[model samples]
Target: MNSIPASRRWMYDRMYTGRRGLKESFVHGVEKFITIACQQQSYVNEGKLRCPCAKCQSTKIDGVHTVRLHLFKYGFMSNYYIWTDHGEEMANVDNNLIGASSIGINATECETSNSMHDMVCDALRQHGAFDILENSNVEEPPNEEAQRFYNLLSEANCPLYEGSSESKLSMCVRLLACKSNWNVPDECVDFITKMLLDVTPVNRCLPKNYYDAKRLVSKLGLSARRIDCCVQGCMLFYDNDYGKNDGALLQCKFCHMPRYHDRNTGSSTKKLVPVKTMFYLPIIPRLQRLFASVQTAGHMCWHYQNRSTSGVLRHPSDGEAWKHFDRVHPDFAADPRNVRLGLCSDGFNPYIQSTTPPYSCWPVIVTPYNLPPEMCMTKPFMFLTCLIPGPRNPKAAIDVYLEPLIDDLKKLWIGVQTYDISKKQNFMMKATLMWTINDFPAYGMLSGWGTQGGITDKRRLYGVGKVTSPLTDVDTLINVSSGRATEESEKIIQLEEQVRKSREEARQSREQNKRLQCQFQSLFNVVLPLLPSDTQHILQQQVDQQSHDNHDDQQPPPTGHYGDDY
Candidate 1:
């Protein structure tokens, strides 16, 4: 199959009057196109093919006949003459032929433009922001937010150089991905990017350094906010109250700890840097972003849409906790797009296997349970909400660090206006924190539970140098002091009685076994004398073997299965 270049005017030009439909030549061209597409891919035999009509734009999969009808109605998408999505390879086409057909523009330039355009469109489509570029019904100009998004999209489409396939946004994104995957240092990335720019064409559009690349990418609306925190984790210097003074508080209100390190006596011009700081990634914008893409927007409803009916606990949605939540908040549950989240936080040594001093950093991760089981816990979906810097565990003071996250949760509970890309409409999207994930000590820190003592009762407090009986419950002690038989004391008495009964039964069984053994020995001695010499010898051997087996069973088990005898 041959690719018809976009410069072939007859393929796209309308050549018919109102009464008659498309010209016979165009119809013949469509028929030949369909025949070649079907012949190139085996999947088209399954009764469907990717429609390349301008309306569908190869995004919609439809029956072969329907695709043909769409082409007849709307014509093929512009510059889709390559048919790369179906089977035609761009490498097979002659660059000189494409260049000659398309006026002054050469094949490389055209290909680069197409590639950048497709890349930008695909990204916007996934983010559910494609409508901003595609929609033509707006009478008024785009708002500030929409206009900003459009500018970013334009930058993403701008090529790095005149014939280069890489765009400014693409280069920045690839560089960032490489930096993250390889743990590359900022200085190294700056050096490499600088070297590339120096060697490349003078008209290059690439970012100057690592920071420049990061700045360009940060405009995508997923940037983190850094907030100074107290060294003792007492409070954060955030919110509007601190805005006027620019968070210039000198010390923590609770602990009276200095907010910043002591300044050098000689260096009076040194900046006052915070003793500790945490990075907080707001949850609302992230949750809204999830519903922007059609793929993820549909998935965000999987918990409700794919709710199990067989009464099996396959997913969190199948559990009673989720159902009870729905019963309590019907309004939130009514909208499948409303998110349900699980928060998880843990402290780990970031500098593993190092000789450096011991340090712990806590990362608070938020997972949306709206996705299916397979996707809900994946790294991509696990949103890192905060990074708590530490030289030691926050312990009970962890709540002080969680204040910002709690504020975000409260706002989410009230609801936020979000665009649902799958539905193509705006709706109030609310979210609730269903539960928390943490280890025992972390749980104690988060919930104020005394995990160090009282296994059955979490509320019981035990302090240093305090004397208490391990077996006595708080209620039992109080009842004993009052000389009253309380429920706890009665329960303890019942347990003791049950233990006594079990011991008595065990003793009776042991006595019965001894009596039976003695009777068997007496009977064996009586029968031994009446037996013949050979029969007596065999009977004695059997009795001896049985005794030996019984002795072995009473002894401790061997440490290993494969012993020297075996």
Candidate 2:
């Protein structure tokens, strides 16, 4: 009745190869014993198995004696120990139940043993194998849902001999994500590829190498169109009108900065330049891709129905700006498919600290705020809209680079013919640039609002006549039609102030003229009439003289005195 030490108990726990096998043996033995007992007189009516042991025969005691008792005491306890690695008594039921060389209460020679017990013991040894064979022989009906999943696996066309391309792609993508998330080196991709190809089955077709794998990944990702930009960060190669005119270009139209360095050109006929390329990923296709999946499309619409409006402003949607936007453009806000996007940009040095004179790069990112707040701000949910390649920040000229984006946004506002994946049809897809998120410097660059003013001044400066007209009348509207504030809001405020000041000055000037007229009338009617005709003539002559002096001197009278006329 003593227990084994904790350290040594693991050996007892792992005595069997598989715990499942042990469980099966115990189950089959009990079932076979019941089958044998039922063959005898009224087993179910009596509610006990007729044990043929000498002890049971003499005492008339009958039940599932060996099977239930041994299984409950040994099998269950052994399974616990197998999991927890702690038990007092080791389970030795397998050898005992199999009728091996062990002394027991019902010990007897096989030749003289009860046939039922022998058969029960034999069944335990070959327990689950028979059931497995039976299941394998039975065929299950095919299912439609299962067929779709099977089709996904079949898309890769890898044979059973080799691993499926779907699985390999999944693994590769996971590895790449991990590498990026952990800031691991690019070599990790090569290492992973080599390890997989070497250790995995030979027939499998992976990427030829890491570069090929990268290309495959790019193909699977959002499509990017590269546009050359001025090295001075002056402008993008494609303008708002560049799409209309296909004239050849060599330099920036505005700054006349060369697109490429002179040394980059080859002596041969081909001209080469140090490519300052900006990779722009169109938002419409990305938005369409999100809707292509049923689950994601459903999640994207969650903000409309499930969003909380506590007015504490947990998300941008809860703010007054968003409300104003909705109010201004009720038609655009009517469709949940009309996405609201938040833009973000920040500059960083791609090289490590060890590198001297680091180069700066700015990546523009956009988040679809149409998703719920929890999912909307997550890194994976954010989309890379463009790369603003730079040694220096684009500053106020970020708009020049944003011409393509603004143009596309205008197109979206006008209604781009887009394929609605969920509806399985083509329709107009419109989206709005709800707001931008950035630091102070980036704010000035993106919004064109300088940092020379206080917070209230900035607000008033931005919120007045400078406000962009919410109509797509021009290419420079920059989502003004989406109810976003613009430079015109400031101009409108300034104009109103100018009109008020002009009106107040005119009113004051008229009041001053009325007082002067009243004074002149009093002098002529009361004082001048009392004088004689000659005196009047003399006074008139003096008044005329004073008027002439005033006109010549351009001077007003002293504080309390009129001229000699008084």
Candidate 3:
């Protein structure tokens, strides 16, 4: 290690007690360092130089402006007195630099580095996991899936901006969560992001819009697949056979309804739009992701690990249904990692207060019961598997929408190779659909039963005995007919009485108004003849204008008035 220079001792103690009580000398040092670093042409690569901040420690390369900002915020790394990484040279300096080993990771550096990344590395290290760190043993390389997950982790660890504590992954997640919680439209979200970009000082890493945000976050591997469905919900335009071209069919096989809305017959350049679409979020990848995370992997076995044996029914594991399932499927229950999932679905109006035409949208949610009761029921644990599109409820036709989910469920039951981060091993993990939750109408639709007091058993039938109408008896029929006639007669009598009173009051008011107008006209005529010629002219004009106004008021309104539209 090179000895620290006497003149540059301020680099070690970047802060000092000044008139302001405590002031940062780090900003001045960062400015001087950046000026010197930028002068080394040989060390600069593509207009960028190595950042020697505490967090980066010469590992990250950035432009001069970003390097200065990072150095000012996090200060220099420990024992970096020589600045060798930034083209600085010293006589007889050791090539094996100080603080290069994993053991030498100091508190300041760790605090400045990405906290989430540190937690992930620590958890993996505890399980004897390898391949995450570049220096880890490469004798046994990670499998394709694990390698992909590590790549995603690296992308997620990237900071949102230079010297920012928040990561790109976390920022994107928060933005998406806000969008969902407030039911904000995609266009609105895009507009808000543009506004955010304008207000922010450093926006290079910030997403430009909603699409950019989604694209960046998609690296996490959780995404929905939009499959075209029949407008009538007869069947999905999905093909299991790779060799078959049935999925490309323009019309439904069962209903023969056109796949797209009517378009110009001669226009081949137009896009083929699906009349209906269902978004299916694959369950296998999500289930694998649960095992991939150290925090959630151990929680997946919480039900088995913390089973209540005191005869208290605190969790679903204590229920008879769970016990029966375990007894019947001993092989599946042998491993605590095997997932038990419960499905739930319901329809809701997306536009609750809108005056636009109403429509129902059904979302199918799946929850893993392997987690503890409290965690399994929470919103974060509840995964939305499918979004069934609807202008109307799917009803019994919901089975068509659930086809993709059912196929995934079947595959999960068989088992898939998954890597468990907590166990640091790969195993064939299995899952099963334990039950379904829904309201009475949804239950009837899912089970193919009538919601109106319908029983499943054929032996027992409701309202099976012979029934007769109340009007079957002649006396009852006569009495009902007489009562209806009497009610109608009373209504008519009351209506006529109201009409007579209104007409009589109107006639009396008209007569009174006519008498008053005649008396006023007679008095005006008598006064008009006694007036001088100039005065008479003005008085005549006033009389004529009053008569015209009265004539207009007495006349009926035009037959085709604008108010008739209502």
Candidate 4:
């Protein structure tokens, strides 16, 4: 801390104005502005003399023309840590602070001959970095696809920078949402890439894996939708009871192999469509909302004659959709079938199955499990729906601009086109449902399960554990320590261990019966079929009769495997 000593008071007086304002002369820490302003006044009064302040006349403190803003948004943390969106270097680092990185910020003082606010805001905006709070133009009339993509990107609030913990999570989501992995129409992809690259870059990207994962996914043709549910035996998670577990679609890689969803069901139909099913479990609300958005978009698109890849055209800036795509390929511009996308109120998930190859799930959140208590009481499996990104990393190309994707929900709401319930509604599946509202703070250590009235504590404004929403600027990222899950897992292990002792006694008879059975044949064959046909038939009949008797008895299965899948 720099201070003006008693001996230096004379120097300070000569250096500063010592302005004769008897009302107030408050001196707080680092009052550089007052110092400079006073110097300018003194210089003007003293026969236009040069301002002789120690800062201007001597090398007392570090000599650098740096601009710093007192970000009240950071609360107490700002006392030590400086926050910046620009890619600049930090000369100050203290043990108590998480220092700043220069990405998306102005490190070099811009040479603009304007006020500090104008200079700063202009520099930031020119580089695609603007005070998000100052402008709500994100919803301006974007051309067709531009509007669609923005709606998808707006699935949830995006946080950036290091001021609040949620900022980190938002940054993570934004970096992960790039469109390059989606094979988006080139114009849309190009436009989104330009915006993202202008804001976020790789190594310094919000989620460090943002770049690597996109690259790997692009190479492997993978999407978060690849995993369905882990608890459903890697099968499609049908209407699970509200409290049952759900596995990630991507984790269940083989779930789409035909053998998973359609192995049985007794029907000889060549194909059966999978209806949208909700398993019994609480998930991030944002996922449900995103699904809702997609479903709305699909509805609007279904009605458009020449557009299938459409969303709400909130903004008119969507340069001619087909024309833009045509720039992607000259011939594509003239192709009649290469129609532009159309997004309405009820729309589609960009990634829906076509019964063709490369089937991938619509991008949604990927969870790390066991969030803290403040998020909610149910230690439920928590995950987010990852939104698709629009373009390249900021590091890849700072000035690139891609075309826009639309937001169908807004279009439907504005009555861009009249709605009709009779219009080819897919009764079984609103497959593109984009989003739902669920709270799963990335850093909420105890954010789920086993809290008071978690069953009854589901209210929003009055919820016991609930807090303010992001757009309100009254939120903070929940601080989640990484080792929390390990602690929870140990507790689960102890509980399971105790249950086994009691269950073992109850399971003895079934275990004994199972030990008496043997493999009927080798891996490839069932020897039970080798017997005479009539004999086999009689055995089958007896088996059926015994099965009926067991059902009448209502006995517990002899073992966990007694009624296992054939």
Per-candidate TM-scores read 0.59, 0.53, 0.56, 0.19
What is the Å distance of residue 372 in model 2 from its true position? Answer: 1.1
Residue-wise C-alpha lDDT for candidate 3, range 1-566, written one tens digit per residue: 13334446667676554633223555666677777777765345368876777776554567778888777667786656655455444223432322122224344543533244444333222222233222322333445786686777666656667756555665666677668778889999898889988998887777888988788777767788999999999988887522435688899888799888877779877887788899999988889877875446767877776678899999888876677667777998899999888878899998877787889999999999987664677665689998999899998788878877777776777788887754556788888776668886886666554446212221012211111211111111111112344455455445545756766776677677779989999998888889899999998898889988976665533433222232
lDDT of 2: 0.52
**Model 2: per-residue Cα lDDT over 1-566, one tens digit each:** 02333432332232246544444444554455446445533445556542323222211224666535544344332112211111111122221221111111122332332243332222221111112222333233223332332243333323224322133444444555666668877787778778777876762656545676556445544568888877777666674543543124788776787776676334664566645888888876677655543224445555565446565777667776766777777898787777787888888988787856867788888888876555677654588878877777777667756766776677777776554322334456688787677786776667665444332253434532233222223332343322345545454455556755766776676667657756875777688888799999998887778657745553332432111121
Assess the local accuracy of residue 428 in candidate 4 as a C-alpha lDDT between 0 and 100.
Answer: 17
The global C-alpha lDDT for each of the candidates, from Candidate 1 onward, is: 0.66, 0.52, 0.66, 0.28
Residue 109 error, candidate 1, Å: 32
Who is ahead in TM-score, 2 or 4?
A: 2
Worst-scoring 10-residue span by lDDT in model 4 = 396-405
Best by TM-score: 1
Going through the candidates in order, what is the number of backbone clashes in each?
A: 0, 12, 0, 125
Q: What is the C-alpha RMSD of each candidate to the true structure, in Å?
A: 18.5, 21.1, 25.1, 26.7
Q: Model 2 off-target regions past 4 Å?
A: 1-154, 157-166, 178-192, 239-248, 263-271, 307-314, 351-355, 417-426, 454-566
Number of residue pairs clashing in candidate 3, backbone atoms closer than 3 angstroms, sequence gap of 3 or more or interchain: 0
Give the C-alpha miss distance for residue 142 in model 2, angstroms: 26
Between candidates 1 and 3, which one is better according to TM-score?
A: 1
lDDT tens readout by residue for model 1, 1-566: 13345444455754487636688878888887788768743344566676778766664556778899988888876655455456554345555433222333233433443343354444533422343223323233433453466457655666565534456877787788779879999999999898988888753578899999899888978779989988888888777422334266788878889888888889867798788999999988788777764435666877765678898898888876677667666887888888888878899999876789999999999999987776677666789998989889988777767767776776677777776644556677888877667886775665554556433231222111122322111111111111122334445445545756766776676677668878999999988999899999998999899878865554433333221231
